[model samples]
Target: MSRLEPLTMPVPQSASPATPAARFHNVEIILPRQESQAAAQMICEVFRAANDLFPGAPYRTHVRDLATQMRSAPDGWKPRTAIFLGGISTRWTLNSGEKASLQRICRQTPRCLFAGSAIFLLPETGLNTRYETAVHANFAAAAKEEDLPCAPAGTLTTVSDRISTAISSFAALRLLTTYLREDRGAFIADAVCDYLGLALGPTADHSRVSLQLRQAAGGDALIVKILELMQRNIEEPLLIRDIASQAGVSPRKLERRFQEKTRTSPLAAYRKLRIEKARQLLLHTSLPLTEIVAATGFGSRSNLTEWFKREYKTSPQAFRKQYYAEREPQRSLA
Candidate 1:
């Protein structure tokens, strides 16, 4: 669902909210692995999700041999590259031919080109995957079906270090491949989740707060925890009194602390975070305005539009258009 070519790919299956197995389906694609250029081209085509990010700089790989080993191996790094999937109908494993083909396309290349488009059904991890090392571009996922959150989908810049984390993101596509001779979908899912956990680190980002703000809170861990909770549940209509009770303080005391540290009331801060989340959804996703309204707890599309106009002086549609128009030149030049 991330991105696909003219070729056929698998589609996601529906499952009841209580059913985990029904949430998955198999997806596969077999590219032309004979010629290096053809193989790289095929890979780029399949990873169109990433290729499209930097339009002028499409993905490329130029490697001549697979027998060459890496210059040096790092400690505690067991380098093995394999694809994982879920809801497969047949057993699969990496046969000699496919493994050799992959080595020729990836391992042999000095800088192998890789892209993947797939979807993964995940449990309630609060965390998802992403490929960017910094925080400029949008973090995109596939469609939102029912209430399931899509896995992070993108391209990897390198084949070492945390390459597994980046590649696991591409598995968000609805397609499944059977290049393996044994059933490894479950194993792949586990590995992907573990790698993603490592990549995302051990803590959730509390809205990218600054050290100055932390100091302003006067080392108030309660205030920091409350702010993080607000960031985590941006869509929920959480009341200040509830937050105050959770912090073991009166609503008035909580408001005083918020004003002292953040120069805003608790509800005001929560609303700001919700609107910010709405802005992100508008920029990164293709969901309808109604869906965005629901996701952000804006009560209605008109309410969302009102707040968006108040903040950005433009409708969501116009904001999206203007944002892209501004970025179009950069993408073209890239």
Candidate 2:
């Protein structure tokens, strides 16, 4: 069995608590490949921070083929990632829990002979928020058939081949990150190659260069770092000072930079980001309102509803209904 421990500490409100030298803490999860209930238990434990897995017996054998993997990233406060990998025959169903513990989507892979999977969870709110959108669109574009299964509430969605390949490609990331920090352009390129099997072309080349230059420019780098930190730990109720500390700056300095760049305080920006995340869950997932609140870092359900009303001029439930109603015709045509 694997152990899941929280590395995050409660962040205080005082700005002095943030120091210039503070770095984001890294939490490690290592799970060895197994076939029995222990494997299921281990997998659940590994993702307990965000989700719960209810593997049917027929699906148990599929776990036999999965290799143990490790992920060491800063804690994501609400949206925990859940992964479902099936072997040649897929029979697993995963339910994103009833509570708001998990926010981000999970990965489920197809029934590949070796490995297949796809991710299910919420979208990214900060940093490279469009990252999930780009990857999802690309994968969908290449998918000839939807092998992925979507079960009723409390069941697992089957993984698609494209999604599975994308997920499996990252199985070697423990090796890749050893030499390249995540901030480097090469790191992103390697990941794209591993996941998409596409070589870096001129467009990618230019994008990488632009990103590098931007990171090397000025306050943008600090902003990027802070965004990364927020993206990682958005589930936690972190104070501005605590976030600033992770970016290696003072609270006041980080706030000043945010105001200059976005015309909003850092806290306001982060809260807005959180609201957007909740909106994603509301629109894309059937998660309960309570879970959405928990996953989005809203202190309570009422707070989430209030925030939604403020941002969209409607309640979350009504918003979800309207979105689905508008999309029903498109879904039917498709």
lDDT of the candidates, in the order given: 0.43, 0.42
Q: State residue 26's C-alpha deviation in candidate 2, in Å.
A: 47
Which model scores highest in TM-score? 1
**Total clashing residue pairs per candidate?**
19, 26
lDDT of 1 by residue, 165-266 (tens): 223223322121221112233323222222223223463353323222333566477677777667766676678888878778898988888888767677
- lDDT score for residue 111 of model 2: 20
User: Which lDDT value does model 2 have at 159?
Assistant: 28
- What is the TM-score of candidate 2? 0.37
lDDT (Cα, tens digit) per residue for candidate 2, span 231-290:
566577688898888778899899888777656676776777677778878988999998
* Clash count, predicted structure 2: 26
Query: What's the alpha carbon RMSD for model 1?
Result: 18.1
Candidate 2's C-alpha runs over 4 A off are 1-219
